[model samples]
Target: DTAVSQTPKYLVTQMGNDKSIKCEQNLGHDTMYWYKQDSKKFLKIMFSYNNKELIINETVPNRFSPKSPDKAHLNLHINSLELGDSAVYFCASSRGQGNTGELFFGEGSRLTVL
Candidate 1:
């Protein structure tokens, strides 16, 4: 089984539409994060949850929100999606908090906003 998995590996939506990506990790990790990769392939962390608690939240637009029902699951919901939202969203998990642990990333959910 994949350590981390995300639903809808590929997503195509129109502008102003709302969408959500679901993620789950079976690695029993204590920390999880949502990262966005732009067209240029620059990766940036949007949010991080440790043990189901909000730990690191980057300065992303309010349209983007992350919810963690439990330690193993973290979901990203985007409202009023825009063209700038088109990119690859990755779900990753680590054994511990901070940058010391290795991150296991999902294949990535590619979002294309038209």
Candidate 2:
């Protein structure tokens, strides 16, 4: 079984439309994160949740929001999607809040906005 999974592996939508990606992990980890990988393959952290608590939030736009209902799930919701929002969103989980542990990443959800 996959340790981490994300729904709608590929998403295509028009600009100004809203979209969301759901993620879940079975590794029983306390920390989960949302990462965005741009076209240039530069990965950046958007949000981090530890034990269902928001821990680290990067400088992402207000249009992007990360919601964690519990320790095992983290969801990303985007409002008024734009062309610039097209990228691969990855869900990851680690053992703790720090960066010292190994992170397990999902297959990634690709979003395309026209």
Candidate closest to the true structure, highest lDDT: 1
Q: What's model 2's overall lDDT?
A: 0.94
**TM-score of the candidate numbered 2?**
0.97
List, in order, the clash count of every candidate structure.
0, 0
Task: Give candidate 1's error at residue 13 in angstroms.
Answer: 0.4
Q: Which parts of model 1 are misplaced by more than 4 Å?
A: none
The Cα local distance difference test for each model comes to: 0.95, 0.94
lDDT, model 2, position 3: 99
Give one digit per residue, the lDDT tens place, for model 1 in 1-114: 888999989999999999999999999999999999999999999999999999988999999999999999999999999999999999999998776499999999999999
Q: Per-residue error at 82 for model 1, in Å?
A: 0.4
Candidate 2 Cα outliers beyond 4 Å, as residue runs: none
TM-score for each prediction?
A: 0.97, 0.97
Q: Tell me how candidate 1 scores on lDDT.
A: 0.95
